[model samples]
Target: MKKTLILLSALTLMVSCMSKEEKMKEAEADGNEAIAVKSKLIEGAGKALQEQGKAAAKSASKGVGDVIKGINSGMSESISQSDVIPEASFKANFEECKAEKIYASNDDKVKKVTIYLIAKNDFKGDLILKAFNADKKEIGRSRLKADIKKDDAQYVDFTFDERTHLLQTEYFTIK
Candidate 1:
């Protein structure tokens, strides 16, 4: 028993006194293993982030597409329901003192009227617009101000109940 114990202690001492090169080689192997594990973890995290970015971009693109479709549908509906009125130009002078018929729609389908006036010279006064139906009955009237310099243009817009046939204009002094 005494001889066996002595031999085991000698073997343990020899192992504890291993060469410096051998110990260094073992430590380097452990470091290489740890680095490989860390590299795999980093690669996995990068892949997850890339997938999340792709998903977010796809969702945002879908949202923008939906908004554009809604706007286009609304615009199409409005254009299909409204009627197109022809543009008309009229000229008026203070000395003429005549009521000019600017526009006269053949049918009773007129819903809105727009009148444009270009000042021949410097003039600051009022203009009266009268709307008549097919039966020659006054339906609507509006007053517009011509506070414009020479060669400048002014617009007068009128919206009525359902229909108008004729739009006449006459110039009057500012009171």
Candidate 2:
């Protein structure tokens, strides 16, 4: 009876020390279950975020569309063809001069036009003023010798009464 008890104990110990193949299979089953649970959680989170993103995008698109529509309506009402009269007055730093439209009288009987220039620095150049009619045709032109000191403002006048309604002015360095 004692021998039978020892044999039973040895058998239990052997069973407890399982084979490598059986241990590997058990570990694989546990790993696969963990991976499946993690995958399910990740998929659920991703779907929830995707739905939120879609809703946000739809709301943002509607807001942008409303703003664009408002701008278009405002522009169409404010800017008409008849309101596009020739511009008047231009002031800027005169370094490296360029031609610029000054004023539009829209009156063919305008006898005199004046251009005002303020010299931030001492300047000596030829200032040219040109007048045009409603048809964009040049009607009169005048050139003036400019010799101005800093902080000086001068007016260059042109006698123009030949159906000229628009004025453009430019300046060039005199060599």
Candidate 3:
């Protein structure tokens, strides 16, 4: 028993001692260094969940933009009958506003529509929310009402039947 205890003691000593706190601190330091390196390599990757989120956001933004462009171009090519759609300008503006402004979505499942827009005071301007069906017919319209000062953000929300909504457009003007 004494010899066995002695062997066990030797093995324990051979495995260097590190407190949990100390190990965690060292790990955190290494993690910070890794984050710095990754930031330099991918730029925006260092944001919060450095590994998963930033890339996803950038990719999604690009994809959505491309889709919107395609839609606008397609619309302009076939929409000669409509004098109201600003075709080119509106397409660019929609993507730009989406990238610049932060908006939230509220879904009306029963109505089969999702309304997304910058809320009242998102900007010192009149914000228009327009919903269209797949047939390119207007289904709903609302103007955001709120007092927003310079550099202030706004919360916008609207609801319609999800089934009826096909393409949504937002128009904003600064007053």
Candidate 2, 29-50: lDDT as tens digits: 9999999999999999899979
* Number of the top-ranking candidate, with TM-score as the measure: 2
For all candidates in order, the CA lDDT equals 0.55, 0.57, 0.48
Candidate 1 vs candidate 3: the lDDT winner is: 1
Stretches > 4 Å off in candidate 2? 1-110, 161-175
lDDT of 3 by residue, 1-175 (tens): 9999999998897677677888999999999999888878666534545777778889999999999999998875343211233244333333223212222355424322122233222334444545544555566554545455544444444333444332333332221
Among these predictions, the greatest lDDT belongs to 2
Give Cα distance to truth, residue 161, candidate 3, Å: 6.1
Runs with alpha carbons beyond 4 Å of true place in candidate 1: 1-112, 159-175
Per-candidate TM equals: 0.29, 0.30, 0.26
Provide backbone clash counts, one per model.
0, 0, 10
**Per-prediction RMSD in angstroms?**
16.6, 15.9, 20.1
- For residues 12-77, could you state the per-residue lDDT of candidate 1 as single tens digits? 998888689988999999999999999999999889879897898889999999999999988654
* Candidate 3 colliding pairs: 111-161, 111-162, 112-161, 112-162, 112-163, 113-161, 113-162, 119-155, 119-156, 122-154
* Residue 170 of model 2, lDDT score: 18
- Greater lDDT among 1 and 2 belongs to 2
